[model samples]
Target: MDKVFNAITTSGEEGVFQTELCKSFSLDSRDGSRLVGNLEKQSLITREKALYNGRWTYKLVVKKSIPVDAIEQKPIDLSSVEGAPCICCPSQHLCSIEDESNPISPAKCQIIEEWVTISFNKFMMIQQTEII
Candidate 1:
């Protein structure tokens, strides 16, 4: 399942065809289909019907990434919004003027307001800290 998920994620938004997945994992059609069905049921991936090499098949796309690491990590403070745009935007690939989907450019994004406010607050905090 991990290998299958990896392959689909590696393909990115383009997704991986069921036939290709079966071939790569040396899995029979039934097994591959079953695995894909399970993953889809879990909302981990979506299997969309697509044309592959003039044949009909499903393209498996990752809906979300599951963190595999077990290491304990510090929680990031939400009050500090540094690098928020890059961290939050899902349509970075379509950010250019040529892309019609980009209704708000990064320079004009309302989402960045929180980030700017947080940054200003941090800067003020540093100034106060140094003055003391």
Candidate 2:
């Protein structure tokens, strides 16, 4: 979705972006997924993992049809906002990943994979699998 939205807004009627272009940032394709949304929700046409040239890219549409700046935003104080983490408008409510308010800071993300999912097969260990 992020890719599609970027393709449209960044390129225009051509509406295209290559994931390889992301290499400049050194982003790993399998590290995580990107979503383009107004308030933390993606809408309109979306694409995912479309490898055109040894790269993965997701294409999606923007609901408002506006371009959002990908540059790092200055961290803000989340405590001031009632629903800090739940804020849809980062400009108004959410703080930058650098802000202490951010449970996961941008700096933290850069140093490590902030969102690493580890799967352990408890069934294979000492626990039995149960149907919930």
Question: For candidate 2, lDDT tens digit of each residue in 3-116?
Answer: 534545655444344354345335455432343333124355344446566655644323444555865578786533333233343433433555676755544443233122
TM-score of 1: 0.48
Candidate 1, 5-57: lDDT as tens digits: 88888999888999999999999999999999998999989989999999999
| lDDT over C-alpha atoms for residue 88 of model 2 | 49
State the lDDT at 12 in candidate 2: 46
lDDT of each: 0.84, 0.42
Task: Kindly provide the TM-score of model 2 when superposed on the true structure, using C-alpha atoms.
Answer: 0.27
Any runs in candidate 1 off by more than 4 Å, and if so which? 65-132
* Root-mean-square deviation per candidate: 12.3, 18.4
State residue 95's C-alpha deviation in candidate 2, in Å.
28
